[model samples]
Target: MFWNGSTQATIQMSTTTPLLWAAFRGAVGDQLPVILALISAGADANAVTRAGDSNALMLAVQSGSEVLVRALVEHGAEVDRAADEVTPLMLAARIGAARIVGSLLELGAAPAVRIGKYTAAEYAWHGGHDQLAELLEVCAGAPSRYDQSS
Candidate 1:
């Protein structure tokens, strides 16, 4: 995906069942209880689809649920997993979930990590997600200071 700076970030991402279940929670809007049940039943929080890209995080962002985002993160989803050059944050931005973006950023989601080679900023801009582009830009803009060693 590439950022084009509008509000329609284009992406090359994907997902499945366990990921589907997670995404469903967001689709229905506020179904954490069900998600929690699935998790308890052995849903692989980290399970990626056939291409190994797009996990539960992708769904959470797509669904725009901060509660679900936190639940997934707390459940041990890989905050940094990538799919076809698309990261969770990238997907979240594509969907225009500002809250999800902020939450992911706070969780340490990489701001500079690229989908293949394109950064989230590039994808956000390309996808026309101005707000997302801005958020990703800020999250990835700095070196986090801690990352720059003396």
Candidate 2:
């Protein structure tokens, strides 16, 4: 915990559950409203998986739940916060969730970041997102050393 002398602050160690991770997985099975309610019930929106592998935002993005993504963003989930390996924008790109990808982009999600040996752009390309790849190129016009190097 850290106190700036005016308030309390603490970090939630990476200790998320299977159900919790699944709930954010590709937004595949998670009931958005239910999960949001869970947050109300003390669920950590930024929690990491049991494997310490991903956060709620990543799950929602990969799951392509733009609605949930927006909700998490609105609730203060960091757009670039990552678990050990995956990231929300990476997940969204991997799943070809364009809207979610765009949402993250608008929220300041980087177009390029290494994820377990692959960049977010690479993830989108491998995930069969030709459009997304093009979008990445467009979004990252005049690739920087990071974009090219990655």
lDDT against the true structure, each candidate: 0.69, 0.69
**TM-score versus the correct structure, for each prediction:** 0.72, 0.68
- Residues 1-150, candidate 2, lDDT per residue (tens digit)? 234343311122224553254455435565776767777777776766555666778766656678788877776688888786767777777788888888989888877666677766777778998778778756766353345575
**Model 1 compared with the native: what TM-score?**
0.72
> Which regions in candidate 2 have their CA more than 4 angstroms from the true location?
1-22, 25-30, 115-117, 142-150
Error of 2 at 10 (Å): 30
Q: For this target, which candidate reaches the highest lDDT against the unseen true structure?
A: 1
The candidate maximizing TM-score is 1
The Cα error of candidate 2 at residue 134, in Å, is 1.6
Q: How well is each residue in 40-104 modelled by candidate 1, as lDDT tens digits? A: 89887776655455567676777678888888888888887876667887777666667877898
- Itemize residue pairs with steric clashes in candidate 2: 26-62, 26-63, 27-63
User: Any idea how many clashes model 1 has?
Assistant: 22
